[model samples]
Target: MRLLPRLLIILFVIFAPLPAFAVNPDEMLSDPALEARARTLSAELRCMVCQNQSIDDSNADLAKDLRLLVRERITDGDSDDEVLNYIVSRYGEFVLLKPRFSVRTLLLWGAPVLLILAGGIALIVFARKRAGKPTGSKLTEDEKARLAELLEK
Candidate 1:
């Protein structure tokens, strides 16, 4: 009976949703809609200091500054597109979590496929060369005779 309560408490603790933001309580917008938009924008912005983490998930000082800048832009009545454009203009496309598809990004995305195709072609060529013939020259008649004589011994 006591185990049931303990198990319930453990399950509740294990399954509870933890807070997801590194945004301080003081940094949050009072307007829930604006705050939600800020959160969304923050999530889309990459943390330059922590390359793999979104600004919203990063605890870096630069990320915090970016969060504040986003909120400031929102409060200044910038549309979501305007804010994103401003950030991109300031920080370049690399600051975006999902970069816009463009010529440069297309190259970045396509280079690996191109490399793999090249590698596969090289591998096929190599395999064909390897399969074409045995690696060494055929033994001469004299060498064969000597090999047979040695084997008999």
Candidate 2:
């Protein structure tokens, strides 16, 4: 019946994006505190091969390796900063999406906003100048009479 199709659609909508358990369930920590730390480190660590993605969400083999590495480092008592520094040292910063604020990244952080502000100022001045101006020449009475006469003929 029509109701069966509706039910199937509802089920599909509810479960369409469930995460794939590609990671071995055994690899997950049973201790909540350690698992929380693992997640924090995972979010901080970028996947070397998949440069834009964090290791936690990426399904790439390298991401898995990075996740395992993060857990290993955390277990070895590395602070989050130490783990981040270690990755940055090896990957040379391209792996990070959110780069640290520095002289090299100044343009990336400031250019778009500066461009937008410059554009907005230009637009405001342009609009004001345009709005203040007359659209056409103002005709004298004689000129209007001549135009009327020309139109009549």
Candidate 3:
């Protein structure tokens, strides 16, 4: 029916994922290889303005500038590492979408595992203490004598 088709269309319009690449046509490199590399690098770099989003996914002005800088570096024949180092030098390690593991980041990478292990150990200790405890109190000598006398009577 016509109504069914219109409802389906409306649902599709509401639910369909639209393309959301933030790169403008002018920002793209002419060379296919360089453009691909630039895109890859852009995806790794964090947008300063939109701290949670990668430069590739962010529509921020700073993201645009970072994209341009990546393209410029790739065109200048800098290796991937060189380009990353250059950016890190300028913006600090926080500019990377994924922070590189190093001695400085050891605590950040290890804290969760350490915490989970500590929690498991604590839980085991608590369970042991609970299991070892007697649920009912032992009867005193007077209570035992009273119980025996009551039974005889």
Specify the highest-lDDT model's number: 1
Backbone collisions counted per model: 0, 0, 0
Which parts of model 2 have CA positions greater than 4 angstroms off?
Answer: 1-5, 18-22, 137-153
Clashes of 1: 0
Error of 1 at 61 (Å): 1.8
> lDDT values of the candidates?
0.95, 0.79, 0.93
Candidate 1 vs candidate 2, lDDT winner: 1
Q: Provide the lDDT at 111 for model 2.
A: 94
TM-score of each: 0.73, 0.73, 0.81
Q: Which candidate is the best by TM-score?
A: 3
Tens digit of per-residue lDDT, candidate 1, span 1-153 = 999999999998987876567899999999999999999999999999999999999999999999999999999999999999999999999999998989879987888999999999999999999998888889999999999999999
Which of candidates 2 and 3 reaches a greater TM-score?
A: 3
Regions more than 4 Å wrong, model 3? 1-15, 136-153
Window of ten residues with lowest summed lDDT in model 1: 14-23
Candidate 1 global TM-score: 0.73
In angstroms, how far off is 41's CA in candidate 2? 2.3
**Candidate 2 residue 3 C-alpha distance from true site, Å:** 5.6
Clashing pairs in 2: none
